[model samples]
Target: MRGIADIFGKEWATPSAVETLMRQNKPKGFMCVSCSWAKPADYHTFEFCENGAKATLWELTSKRCTPEFFAAHSVTELRGWSDYDLEQQGRLTDPMRYDPATDHYVPCSWEEAFQGIGAQLRALDPKSVIFYASGRASLETSYLYALFARLYGNNNIPDSSNMCHETTGVALNKVIGVGVGTVVFDDLAKCDAFFFFGQNTGSNSPRFLHPLQEAAKRGVPIITFNPVREKGLESFINPQNVTEMLTGKATPISTQYHQVKVGGDIAVLIGLCKHVFACDDAAKRDGRRVLDVDFIEAHTKGLDEFEAKVRATSWNEIEAASGLTRAAIEGAGQVYVEADRVIGIYGMGLTQHVHGFENVATFVNLLLLKGNIGRDGTGISPVRGHSNVQGQRTVGIADKPKLVPLDRLAEQFGFEPPREKGMNTVEACHGMIDGKVKAFIGLGGNFVRAIPERAAMEQAWTRMELTVQIATKLNRSHLVNGKAAYLLPCLGRTEQDIQATGPQAVTMEDTFSCIQGSVGLRTPASDNLKSELAIVAGIAKATLPPNPKVIWDDWVGDYGLVRDAIEHTYPDMFHDFNARMFTPGGFYKGNAARERIWNTESGKAEFTTPTMLSSIGFDDAPGRYRLLTMRSNDQFNTTIYGMSDRLRGIEGRRDVLLINPDDIARAGLVDGQMVWLVGDADDGVHREVGPLKVTPFRLPDGCVGSYYPEMNPLIALDHHDIESKTPANKSVPVKIRA
Candidate 1:
């Protein structure tokens, strides 16, 4: 085992360092709560996670955003500021609409901001508006966002989910009845074996690594397959845990780690399922007790298609396709077949590739092959990244299937919702390019940096009739102004939530799909800090008037009524949500959590077999390398907390790209060598869509990885996961040049 110094590349760790890793959930979000939609009764044991804590701190804390701060700096001045510098300026002091005459954001009254927002909405054909939801929205606020959008007669519910997990819903609806994950946190307790694929638990979902660690401690085998080697998969000393922190003790994590090539998850997943099926078939042929034939026959269909693909797949193809030896894959399969209570979990590493959705389906098939569903310690867990991202999608946030959302809107408030489909986040940006979408309203999020195609995304926002952001702090998106742009500040996760009704809490979902409650503990950083719900209400009031609209006031003030509205919209799962969520762990909304009842067409778990892309050609063409934009220890998504990457040997900088020794030698470059990453495709894109300046380090040969968002400019926006429209963050074809 490496020393603690080796693990952290520094002294044991620091409190601030630990803090960046711990913040995730807090109830004092800029939105109000509604118990029926699963708002927490209050903070429970483990009420907030580390990442949640950081998010809360970033939201609340002692930071202040006052007019004095803005007066000291202009938009052009803020343009040269670093990400951390921008965030450190603190919470917004007041509602400020951008004034072109002064080229600075002057403080404006809430009344004028609302009046401007309402007039713009009133002028637009309601169908032209797009309401974007960040996962950070509370359940109450999420429901309100959906309701207001639909009431305005537009089904353009493009949300963060479309950018991330829409494929899970799209693929699972055909295979699993419902479009959600199939595991709960408790499910990990009974799991005899765990399979983690294409996930880096260290950065994306650090809290989840605990379960894998516990499974390892219990002597349960954990097979982790990913394209890149992640440090979090190793032993992690939970610095926040008193005993672990004081004792300086750590627990071992992954039992075995396998590095699969980019886009290799599909083959590896299918290979596991095929081996399990083969083991069962061999047992049956030999009159031996091996296969879960009874379960397979009783609960699954399309076995014929599955086995056919498995049987037809050549061993050579399997080995070549997955970048794994036949023995290695079979070993993973052996563990799956041997363990009675097996669980499979994956992340964006699986879903960001070309065949990402298919990869997810195959994992479900592996679970079904062993009849793992609905059983303790057995199911599939997709570790989501953002806190409230899943919640944003759960409440009618989608581009298609307008009827159900529209009908529910009409049923709830007697308004005829728009039946036409809407634009997704990506589509919204693209729509802006084509003059299809006019106004862009961000409920809460940094859209310009969060979305791909930096130039086009910014341009899209610039072209809008009005671009508004309900943000706690200034971000790159806040500057992406339209003709009539405004920056309406909102409360953060760490601030005191207040509405016309009372104090409120925004809700978010965890990696395990369990709904929990969060409330901020810190005092409001600024009096001007407004709740996201209040901002939306103010906007809605301004946009639509006594224009014969649904009484938005009915749902305003007390968020409890928002829960009632959500329950009315989606009754099956949210029934008694207010009461149950108030009881403690809030509420769990996935089928895998609710007694393994998969909401599928056959009402049974389904298996999928994927074709392999074996034998990747590592053609030595000068500086060619597989590049993956990455996150660091001090970064959450695009929010860089600091300039340190403790895991990758990076220090005080994110301007370098990691390259293996052999790759450097082959490319005729040295460590710390300055180089330009020349993109390979000739798509005739913008000037910033190609190569980028980067420093060098030792990484895997033929593999290169760099920090995201900043490095994101290097990746062409057109190069995306075709299925999900997720930026090609994990996989990028590039060349390292002088």
Candidate 2:
């Protein structure tokens, strides 16, 4: 009903919506922009979820945020509008530049906008310019964006990965030599058990529920550990399942759902390892095999040190840190021990923390004990949120110099690419605040709204000499304009992107490493709007000096040429890029860990010993509570589709906090009472989000839940993982005030 209403409410044509729905996730059709979840090889007629429908309808909306709209509304007035309201204004129909004198955005030609931005770039040091790409961009666009950044002289290419799963890459690269998940969609069918930690699968990727439902029907144990008992984790009635929907029979998801406190993942993981070790010890005495001794001896290292640390840790300490009883931990461990094959899955809940690297490493440690990697049904799976986030990284959108093959890129592009390590999301924010970064260019996202320390970021953002945003709609980031800001509207994933070589199809990699083609079907909202590829090429043409070695126009004209360049840069992975992309269901970019080929320094999977038992050291003060920022069902990252959070029973309101009943009473707070959440970061920043209604939820004591991006303010910019520098958004210290 929500999907239908959203389609009609957006004033999108019914026939267009139907056609889009039919084509979404199809072999030759466009990919859904909602999530990175992989589409099945044998796909159903309707492959998209409700959220996917919302994402499609969102792009297909008939309303337009024309130059006239901006002319009527001043930037100051638009700043007061909600994120939903700003986006609701509709598709950006023209290239607009901020006019400080009039305090409004005035329409400008694409040529003028590109030239002005180019002139600004030429005036500043290329190192000071920041190139930010959102996950929604296609592989072709991202490749061009990265090339443009390097050709202009710096590698300050930071994408959405730095904020979400930077830790996954950092941790997995150190331990297993592969940054991406080893498990493919087929693994779900082969695995005997599934263990989900910290991820709220339902809200993030509803399409994933189908596999879990199938696993449930097979009686496969689906164990879950999270702060919130997400409704999706409990049960889900597949909307497509006619009989089940009619009978109101929902498929059970998690067989055992443990409510681990915020920052308790490491403790629980260690506890599970301890139980496995104890069982192995007893089995050894009975001359029975409990551990995969042969696989461990052949394929793994550092088990001695890792096992010693787990054995040294006491049950009392584990219980205290995990907010779970010893018996419960052992019970979960028993399931892990019994299963022949297990797929350990996690999301941002594990990565967005001060000890995010350690959390991921610890999970890997547990999997290693049973020889989980390199097997058919077993591996580590980090569920990515954005559609092309992983693909962006694969095709060279990285801050770190070593992550990208600079030597190969230099050889392929005929230019000396920058060797200096550029800024990640955190460093970029700090650079802006420190008055070092001068220019900011965003491909497709609300940078100012999605990042942390919003107030500081916005203020620092204004200080930048130039800011360029290539987007589909008006966002808060556009409102927080730089000194010389330009908004270049681009065609969305749902719209046709015709080039000189006819219609083009771009590729995207899913969470499972499957690369599939996505081509738009709907007519573009505006003829003035250019494709992301064209916009990037325009910027490059205007910014860089004339060079025959790099032909920007040719690549933009034929994306296959871009694919050929990508293939040349990464021959092993994208060997037959253009040909393979046209293949039905696309191709799988194989993982090194799956083939037992570890590209690490040790030449084998190594177990890591965590120094800390928990991600955050709780103060245990009277008023202190750990904050877990989450996305409502109606929201995707910073984009709020609707006001209501259907799964959580939140109706027409985002200003509400979910707290345990015990904590509500303990903090002297009553249900439905409006209260202030003051930050306890102790960093001298006055961070507080106000008058939120306290709603009782089934969470562990000393832990509370609230919507993300809204509560992103409470998270200090500096409070992040030392290794990965991913923001510690999952575990923030806060206090409640009436």
Candidate 3:
């Protein structure tokens, strides 16, 4: 019951805990600030999962980072603390400014912080400033942040998407003419079968298991493909169901689980398509009409080229690359062929790779082959990370502005918005390192720890003229200060958002484009903490020239004004933004692909063939293993709740490496033995992070798993997906060495 004790110890007695439960469990209350998994309309009494509760408790802790707390701790002293230690220091109660002389963060007034930020921003060319967004920002806050960036004459709005779902957006846009998933939340219940690729929905999105369990109970087959078997997907006991919780009976989730090798998603998809093509030829010879010939001829292009590419690929190549037998692939292929409505669900496992764009394209090609697009129970679904990461993109947050209506924004906001694409997350880091970026403002997220090459980026961040973080709690990002760095504390999603007009409720869009209203019912953590809207407006007011062009003050007082601006900006989708958000389950931003209407240059869904499956294994380098970075069951992204990862059978440790027994033997290492991991580099600069105890785990040979941020140092900044600009965190070349 250590798990139960943590819930009660860190949270039970606190006022924040009581308030959090009231706000979270209330019918149609604020959305959980955890994963982006969609929830059903008939909300349960307790809507939160274990991680969601931890996220809330951690955010709403009674412990406060008062001015006195900062006075005692120098930046130098704090730098020695771990991520968990830093977060445990509690909520930032006031605005702070880094004093270089003392090497400490001294308390500063909100006005002083905003004006200083504005002055620094005004001093630089807009092109040199990067306005970054995190998934935590509400729709209103992100929309305002984007507008502020564009009005300031730059579109350098890099967001968390550049790190996670950019590949899904790029790939889906190319083939389906839509950047988001075509399937709705209800489709989970309707789909005949699900083909899960590279996503561990169990730990990442525990709420998602409700649908998976229901579907499994209904005898709907779920095929899972990942490097390691996740317990949540294999069998789950819903904590909400008293009978299941008390009886200790677990529900089986996946009918078939294939341990695909590292970076093997594309090969597996290609192999499945190859088998499908063979079956199609056989059926056509017997006049059985297996392939969706009419749909393919009418609604798609480049099929002949794609078909030839699949047919030419050999089974030996598929087996060697995917680490799956030909019979196994054919069995999955047969399942796909037999299922009338198939939904393909994938996550970062398939996206964070050199061939991420091609990986997603391969899955889309499979869905399109069977006339799955536009069908009720059939389509592509990318399980997005972060609650409103997708919403941030929807409301105009991007380095390269894709799908944003510039003409509409210009007409509504009375300013010529920047048309040139800006720096993405990786590009922004590089820009900072090269001195090209002068100022940086992050709405939320721990940028330093979240990005690769933390050591290099940490040093690069010191050179910036201005660095501002608008956040709720203390994180590692605040420690890496620029010349004029400021930390502006904002109200948490659980707290009340009271403006001049009265209480305000923000909005957010989930993974599938469902917009939900979020209103915080709890009192603010501190009276000094301001809402994100107020903070953005304050900076905009201080920076922008005084004019009636945009009523910044008015928008701050009333969020409905911001919603009005949003509706005025995107009249088609966000029409009646406020009214639509009030609907029982909120509104669904309809996708063009869902209607089978392709808005592509070809006016149809395009079938593109990958050149060739890239090699995953290192035959020449026998001692090296392909490292796949992942989060523990107790963690969410960069936030570490505790040292234990109960789901993986790991306890009281964060540095242990999960390796296959065969790989351990091959590396001349014993289970439970310690070893250092030396990264393989082509640029003559290598990083080593280890002395980590090796734990024997079930995984494909030559593949090992480790928690992210710890393994982030091993990743080179240069190693990334060119099309999506996402870091290739899943397949890092590393070796077990002394």
User: What are the models' TM-scores?
Assistant: 0.89, 0.99, 0.98
Clashing pairs in 3: none
RMSD of 3: 1.6
Q: Where does model 3 exceed 4 Å of error?
A: 1-5, 11-19, 22-27, 615-620
Q: Give the higher-TM-score candidate: 1 or 3.
A: 3
Per-residue lDDT for 1-738 in model 3, tens only? 345358557643375575566556233578889888775577776777777777777776777888898899998788889988888777888999999999999999988988888888888999999999889899998899999998898889988988888988888998989899999988888999999998988778888898899999999999999998999889989888999989999999999999999888888999999888888888988888667888999899988899899989999988988899999999999999989999999999988987889999989899888998898999999999898999999889987765688888887767788898888898898998899998889998998999998888999999999889998878888888898889999999988899888999988988878888888877787999999989999999889887576888898899998999888888888998987786766689899999999988899999989875752322426676799898988788898888878888999998888988887777778888888887885667778898799999999998888889899988888878768878989888888874
Give the Cα lDDT of each candidate: 0.67, 0.90, 0.86
Write candidate 2's Cα lDDT for 1-738 as tens digits.
Answer: 565476457655446788888999988899999899987778987898877888888888888999999889999999999998999888899999999999999999999999999999999999899999999999999988998998888889989988999999999999999999999989989999999998988889988999899999999999999988899999999888899979999988999999998999999999999999889999999998779999899989999998889889999999999999999999999999999999999999899888999999999988988999889999999999999999999999998888889999888777899898888899999999999999999999998988888888988999999999999988999988889999999999989989999999999999999899988999999989999999999988898998887888998889999999999998889999998995666688788999989999999899999988789744567778899998988878999888878788888898988998888887788999999899998778899998899998888888898988899888889888878888888988998879
User: What lDDT is reached at residue 520 by model 1?
Assistant: 53
Instruction: Compare candidates 2 and 3 on lDDT and give the better one.
Output: 2
Best candidate according to TM-score: 2
Ranking by lDDT: 2, 3, 1
The root-mean-square deviation over C-alpha atoms between each candidate and the true structure, in angstroms, is: 4.7, 1.1, 1.6
Estimate, for each residue in 477-535, the C-alpha lDDT of model 1 and write its tens digit.
88778888888887666555666767664455655555665555445656766677777
lDDT of 2: 0.90
Which candidate ranks first by lDDT, i.e. highest? 2
Q: Indicate the residue-level lDDT of 84 in model 3.
A: 86
